[model samples]
Target: VESILDKENFTLEELLDEEEIIQECKALNKLVLLDAHYVLNSLMFSLRDRAQVEQLLRYIVEEPSEDDDSKRTFKFPFIACEIFTCEIDVILKTLIEDEEFMNLLFSFLEPNRSHSALLAGYFSKTHQEVLRQLVDLIGITSIMEVLVRLVGADDHVYPNFLDVMQWLADSNLLEMIVDKLNPSCPPEVHGNAAETLCAITRNAPSALATKLSSPSFVARIFGHALEDSHSKYGLVHSLSVCISLLDPKRSAIASPLMHYFRNQHMYEPPIPVNPETINAMLPKLGDLLMLLNVSSDEKILPTTYGELRPPLGKHRLKIVEFIAVLLRTGNEAAEKELVGSGTIQRVLDLFFEYPYNNALHHHVESIILSCLESKNDAILDHLLHKCDLIGRFLQTEKQPILSGDNNLPTLPAAGKHAPRAGNIGHITRISNKLVQLGSSNSCIQAYLQ
Candidate 1:
């Protein structure tokens, strides 16, 4: 097969002849699905005219009817992809330089259109230089949405896709992505827009730092999405972006990005609480606990069989884990914000709610250690007094342990009983910290005794 394929390479004359095959296929209303790669490769370089390119693009975009025998006609885009991967420079120059071809190609992205992902995947695989030219012709936002869809829909990683993402960052296209994340846009659009922003920031942090250096730019992009009441998934995307920007490794923009997240609350009803909104908001520790304890109804609870699931269930645990990360920064401002936001109490509530959650226990322990390590009186006061930290710990520790000897159904060992061991260790450590903070306090003395 390799030898046959090697011998079958089309020469210029053979390519010219294959053009007649394209005409023959079209005249008979038949698709050359089987020989698409050969047909496209043969015709690609030879057909450089705008009219010719548009015709090829139309073949890719046009949908055959359900009743038609040529339903697989949409596979033309895959052939186009093969051609793109092989003769990218020649094909890209022809497509990017011609507005009609570019427009026709982009038309495949409309939501109602079939085979949009095929078109997008092919477009994402173009050369970086060609990608820049393509974006210039089709506009960055439109192209970004296409790329975002391609990335989100498939698990496969394409190097060309990463190159295009880097190009967008280098070209300063973050603002274009921000513009697409408005509340008026569809949820899918918002999701893709946010995903694109995240991809750029995650893959190319230096480029993101350049954008984040501008307060207005950060506010315009990340801040705007946060403040848009109707931006559901976009808000989640923005929060994820914030988490990336705030990484201590990328401290260049961390301080300013933290400031934006801390103060921006123009949208209401302030923090989001319900499952749908929680899934959308992608809350961090400060955001999670503050919003959770706002009202009794909004509090986080343990997962129960037959109960309606909270949107942030497992994701919530991940957010709680971030508390330790924020504290690790020793960003005094962030620590103060967490203490002031009533998050410590909420953290305790979450710990108690999911007693089997060993991961949550570890995170709460980190928060306790950080506070003890900081010796910040404000944090101490909130934990000890306002949040009644010791009392709750004592109450949880005193709760009766269920056992099989009573002939009662034991709470499943893998689920409900998993954290009981961790709970004892957590209580002992907190008691030790309280003793060190002040043996003089009656509550501390009593808990220790």
Candidate 2:
């Protein structure tokens, strides 16, 4: 076999003429159904006719309408996997156009907990037309399977998978991934999946609110993400994603997200809770306070069978409160390190900056105000300081002020519907702070008063 295929001395045209090439592919395709390893090993041997080789390979795995007995006859999935994997680029590019081929590829690839790299590699190398074909043919169900596979693997393909997931017009795949964080996965997967989900929402938020009402999957994903395991990466991400997904327009999700905020918990080592998640959710601080009430031992809470603690670890919740504490009152270092580490910005971008058109702004403001009322000077101090900083930037900074003309909020003519006074008042007061400290170096004083 090696001697036959190694005869690359022949030109591409010559190889096409060789009857042996066709015979070999037929033989290999027939036997491939019997023993995948044989073909997988032979894959390294350069086939004389690469095109025909690829076509014959696609035949065994991709042919549609195979009877159960025929499926049994072929010992597929594994064989399909071997082919898809052997010349990953070739298989993906060739089969992607054929709906049946694409379905077979996804079915075989979907179950593996670590196909992310392979899928990503295909996306990276394959032509755009082929990629579009793959995604279009992959379908929502298989796409979800791909998400699950990628998340489970937690492979290097995360970014590539992210690129494709972002282009999806449907939210089922996103919901499926986010939902798993709550319970289907352990703490790490919850957090990692959350970060990926948050990124998706960030890139396409308009698409996000469209599906926020149905967040059963999100609840589960974030529920588990709230844990503070040894690795806080995922937990922090889960926290961020949860906040991003909240939309007062989707009152159902808003309430649940608020519940999530109220139910903050921590994970021990192996799954550390990220302090940043707390800071980003700070604008919704009321939810944190509510969670404290929910977790309190004073009232008897409902328990599941053999329930030990509320699913979220007790210490983990304490950690969450600690983060809330930082959001409310941490020093510049805490903000610089945690909140400033892009987490808070992300939250603000989703809830405060964008999507307010649908009532999300009120929920965000309500959360922040509730946190300000915590009576914990630390929590109150940090928030007040941040708001002051934001106001000063908007009021005095020539860039923000000039830019406002193009991006300013347009109010209704007179009183068709007055905007919320609370938000207006908060801005007014913050602006006042900025005004009082016009030229002097008194940011702290402005924040303090």
Candidate 3:
């Protein structure tokens, strides 16, 4: 029987016709559908007629049987049938849509507290694949209700049906999880539910956008994560990443995104990197900064690509427009504090120590130059080495601009043929104009000195 089943293209009718021979042959191969893993593996291994196999699986799955004895333990056969069958669509559609069958099926989800964990842990590609097919075939609203109910189980320690949502995205299922996982709920519930949704939507930005665009829903979701209730950094960070991915555009939505971040949190200042958490958390932070329009220097700085080009570097420039928005809003306090306390210096040090060969040193220098030019002295005050660093940066950066010199562009700086102004005000005005009008980057460096 096993040999026949193993053949590349055998048919189900062939197996059934030789039932007597199969029964006898079973002594050697030992039909293991009476047991679980063996049963699933057997089903996975078999490649007989799909329709007939599905029929056999349905019979095993749907047949009423007692559960107290090994002889009565029908779990293995049911699971095997689930694995071997390709038309799970017919099974799930009928099972999930039929109220009686769905209740019976859902009952199996818990499988009694004693056996639930071990049995649930038995979730294989077969079970998830079946669930996905079922979700697709069933009504979205109905499936969503079932999902919310399942997740709401206080005893529901592990995340199930997560892939269902992913499959839904693939099939254009409205990320219905967003609605079911209510944000107005308690903090723990909200966080767990949000994590579940994020797990589904992490790489699916359009689906993420679907959730965030719903104003009330998006606001409550983020508000709880940031937990205005208690300034937790991790939740705030997660919320930031979510908001970034959501790409909230409206003033109403974007306002809350920034306001919560700008609002000071009281959590114990960030802890030293736990190798496990750093990799997971850093990328999310980078994405969030991109959405929040927070400067790279202000929050997390770019780490990829070589440094020694523009002040911000190549990696940072791609997102420079977003960072510039932070300056326009005058929300640099957090950034200032971050830089003042050594974070900025550490980032710069890292860049110089690991320089890249093709680094464009001056364009980045131009950006930083532009940024410093627009800022008031107060913002610049916190940036230590403000003058000297600019000087060093200019020395490295000015070569290209100098090379492009056309009649030196008539620099505003005073030289051998310069005119003297009559009053202090005039001199100050001329000095200010010179700073702005210092044509070449090199000339600007000379004027600053």
Q: Specify the highest-lDDT model's number.
A: 1
- The sequence of per-residue lDDT tens digits that candidate 1 reaches over residues 1-449 is 12222454533223223324344323222333525555444344345555555655665566656774432444454444444444334555677655456446545544555655655555555433344443333334555545543332222333234433344455535555566666566666665565555554444334344454344555555444446533445555554455444442332243433433442342212111122222222333343444343223333233442111232344345355555555644555556777777666677776665455566676687667666555356765666677777777777677634222212111324344422323666677667767775665554455345
Q: What is the lDDT of residue 48 in candidate 2?
A: 21
Give candidate 1's error at residue 358 in angstroms. Answer: 4.3
Please tell me which model should have the higher TM-score, number 2 or number 3. 2
Candidate 3 regions off by >4 Å? 1-80, 88-106, 109-126, 132-196, 199-275, 281-449
Q: Report the poorest 10 consecutive residues by lDDT, candidate 3.
A: 401-410
1-449: candidate 2 lDDT, tens digit per residue? 43444564643334333435444444544453434555434533434234544443443433334455543334332233334433343344445444444344333233343444434344233223333333333324444344433332233443344433433324244544544454434555544454445444434333342343234444454455554343445554555555454322222233434544553342111112234433344444333333433234332223221112223333333334334334433234444443344333333332322222223343344334333444344434555564443654354333221121213222222323322222343444434544544345243355544
Q: Give the higher-lDDT candidate: 2 or 3.
A: 2
TM-score of each: 0.46, 0.31, 0.28
Give the higher-TM-score candidate: 1 or 2: 1
Whole-structure CA lDDT of model 1? 0.49
List model 3 lDDT by residue over 200-291, tens digit each. 33333333334433444444444344334233333443353343433222122333334324422422122122222222323233333333
Clash pairs of candidate 3?
308-361, 309-360, 309-361, 310-361, 310-364, 310-365, 311-364, 311-365
